[model samples]
Target: MSTHRALRATVVAVAFGATGLLGAGVASAHVTADIYGSEPQKGGSGAIVLRVPNEEADAGTTKVEIDFKPEYALSSVRYKPVPGWTAEVTKTQLPAPVKNGKNLDVTNPVTKIVFTAQPGSGIAKGDAEYQDFEITASTLPSTVDELVLPAIQTYDNGQVVSWDQVSTGGAEPEHPAPTVKLAAASAGGDDHAAMASGSGESGSGGSSGTDDTARWLGGAGLIVGALGLGVGGGAVLRSRKAGKSNA
Candidate 1:
């Protein structure tokens, strides 16, 4: 077969593997967050992506909101501008102060971050379009093994969906909150110094972001691959019919 045909076959095969692993409902899950790195170092900063995908057959996703767990206080939060969308950040006094890895504390916790699609500009469900809102969060909580973040999605028709369920070790929840586990601290000063010597902090940050993006895109990529496979199959059938007519 041609190079394109082979590529299509590969894509379809990979998608099949994912389906088997994640179950049939994997393709229809609600909007989810994809943190740039799987395990954020305690007291460090990292990139994050909240992927909002519209599930409505005819409506577009009009609004997205993420609520950080109240117990974990982020020292710094930065949002990137998405053209044709507006972002809002809400802050509230924490019931109690939160601590970071370096023993620093934050009094006010960032409560909610909302992103709204401008009219005639947001992603349409029919177009298979999804938006990834990027942000950088710093001074992560050191105490928790995992951070559970809940999100709300709004459609063009004003329908709202909430993905707020927390996953325990048992059966998966209907809607699991976006969770990021914290990596263990370095064992000793020697290893820490060696790590520091090998690369600058910026280098480490860049690598983490790239890895996170790859993880987030992997599932979405399968959808594109499946479509390519369908087109390739159609082409093969057409070619076969043409050859039979000529015979």
Candidate 2:
């Protein structure tokens, strides 16, 4: 009877623990932004992917609106085509002219991007399913180290979630905005242009050197693994010999 009681108690504890973990996972899930490939240097072009997850149990996400801050003054924005979804970009005139990457003054800049899903095509509910929306910028702002994009998610059930809280280096907010950090500008020129030009002969030589170093490290690892196996096998043989002699 005691054994059965203990088994039942263990099962109950496990069930409660699992429920708590599942709840934590759902609560922690939020929209996020990530850069494609290497981080874009300041004053260069780059691509960004926004990942949106549907968290509602009975509703599907049908629309997403991303708001761009005016201070960055992004002038050129383009989005990748997504099947079953329509994308729209809106530009607003700035209060004052701001210098872009080309050092030209811009009076108008892209202010928002909104994506709407077609019928039966939005992010499906359950299992926290997600969709990625990609966008490219021709010129990233040269001054800021990070770009914070606030977003709004609309559900088919008329539910809305606003992710607009700004982080101040303290505890994370409940609905923190998505952000992309930018690398420092290269001294020579735009990083993207350099990559396009193959970074000249010196860059090619550096890449070759790195590849050789990697090959040498791989060979050294294999040799070390073989030596370890040999030592282990010898120890096992010695133990067997001593045991047979004692018998």
Best by TM-score: 2
Candidate 2 C-alpha error for residue 110, in Å: 0.4
lDDT of 2 by residue, 166-247 (tens): 8999999999999988888888654442221121112212222343356556556555545565565567667877999999
Candidate 2 — which pairs collide?
none
TM-score of 2: 0.66
Which candidate leads in lDDT? Answer: 2
Model 2 residue 44 distance off true place after TM-score fit, in angstroms: 1.0
Position 90, candidate 1: lDDT = 76
Model 1 residue 63 CA deviation (Å) reads: 0.6
Q: Give the 10-residue window scoring lowest on summed lDDT in candidate 1.
A: 189-198
Off by over 4 Å in 1: 1-28, 36-38, 187-247
The global Cα lDDT (0 to 1) of model 2 is 0.73
The positional error of residue 160 in candidate 1, measured at the CA in angstroms, is: 0.7
How far out, in Å, is residue 123 in model 1?
Answer: 2.2
